[model samples]
Target: MTINSAHRFEPGATVVRRDIFGDRVWTAAPRRVIEDRGDTLTLAHWPGVEGLAPTTYIDSLGMDSPAARDAARDQGFADLASGAWELGSWRWRDTTVLSRFQAGEHFSVHLFFGAGHRPLHWYINFELPFRRTALGIDTRDLLLDLLVEPDLSAHTWKDEDEYAQGRRLGIIDDALHAQVELARERALELLAERQETFPTSWLNWQPATDWPLPELPSFNGV
Candidate 1:
């Protein structure tokens, strides 16, 4: 799908992964656009909300801890005396951590970094071809994904049960299933040959400290 003329991102533009209701569930750290080559957009990582931590979800806090009460208040919950705190029992922290690489359309590749900025794994996400929308470039995650090691020596298919469940539930139509299968085949072929499309340099690549952090786009529906 073509990028919406009004929302085309240029190099250095900031973009966030579009989430429903601007939820901070998975994506909280925005990515700096490095290049916008129409069909492909390159993004560089920024420090996540957890700073440089390896994981995004913090362990749950105890229900009666002062920290938990403070966190509930900070998150806009009613006072502890009101007994309306949903997280009054526990708090699972969300963060914007890890490095990633995403290309639009067909098959989008994602690379994740571990602690100390070490290369972790590659995630191949099969999705609907991205389309530029009023809500930024939009694509639907197909649920089927392939996970690969940093050196491409080991790999595993992920979320097969989810994908099958989607199919059984009629959420994934035959056409979408075929498209995801094709993308998976192509990804396997690319990995078998050690193609340069996989950014091996990112294993050691670091963003310049002076670069500004990425900002989220406006969320007004058009």
Candidate 2:
């Protein structure tokens, strides 16, 4: 069941942060990726490099499905933002959480549907820091072949018309609200489970719709 009842978010930038070990972890991952003929002209995930494949990452999303493979092809090469995927033919969920604490960069967890829109691939992304040690096997990377291939973002809204742009922008705001509510609920649950998890990471989530681009540096970074 897609949380259709939740407010629809305007497509744009959203800033969310969670505290980790007294350090404030801000999300700096880019939300947009422009690709032209296999060449990403803007915001390269693996910047300063050309056509470099993903060598040390994993895709939690199952890539075995033909449809998933096709979608991956369309996305080009960018870090898998988060966990976004469809479950069977009726459910779809994808989330990307970029943390400077985890890897001094970004990491994601995605879950999506396959050919029939059913649960075909459900996974995560672990953008580990350069010098961080690998602990347990992260399932996010194993599903999407992230190690061998770099992930890419989508520039679908670049040429959108004014009305379409407005709509897209609106989605981003809605998404922020949804994220906040979701996070709050989860945080509470976690707190109940263990008080040690207190002082849960808190972030000032503000979508692009609220203010000018410059005012929100969190959204502008990544």
lDDT of each: 0.55, 0.25
lDDT measured at residue 198 in model 2 versus the true structure, 0 to 100 = 19
Angstrom error at residue 124, model 2:
4.9
Runs off by more than 4 Å, candidate 1: 1-7, 19-29, 46-104
lDDT of 2 by residue, 149-217 (tens): 111121121112322332343422454435434533543343346432211221221122333221112
Q: For each candidate, C-alpha RMSD in Å?
A: 8.7, 20.4
Candidate 2, backbone clash total: 54
**Inter-residue clash pairs, candidate 1:** 48-96
Candidate 2 global CA lDDT score: 0.25
Runs of candidate 2 exceeding 4 Å displacement = 1-100, 103-124, 130-204, 208-222
Q: How much does candidate 1 score in TM-score?
A: 0.66
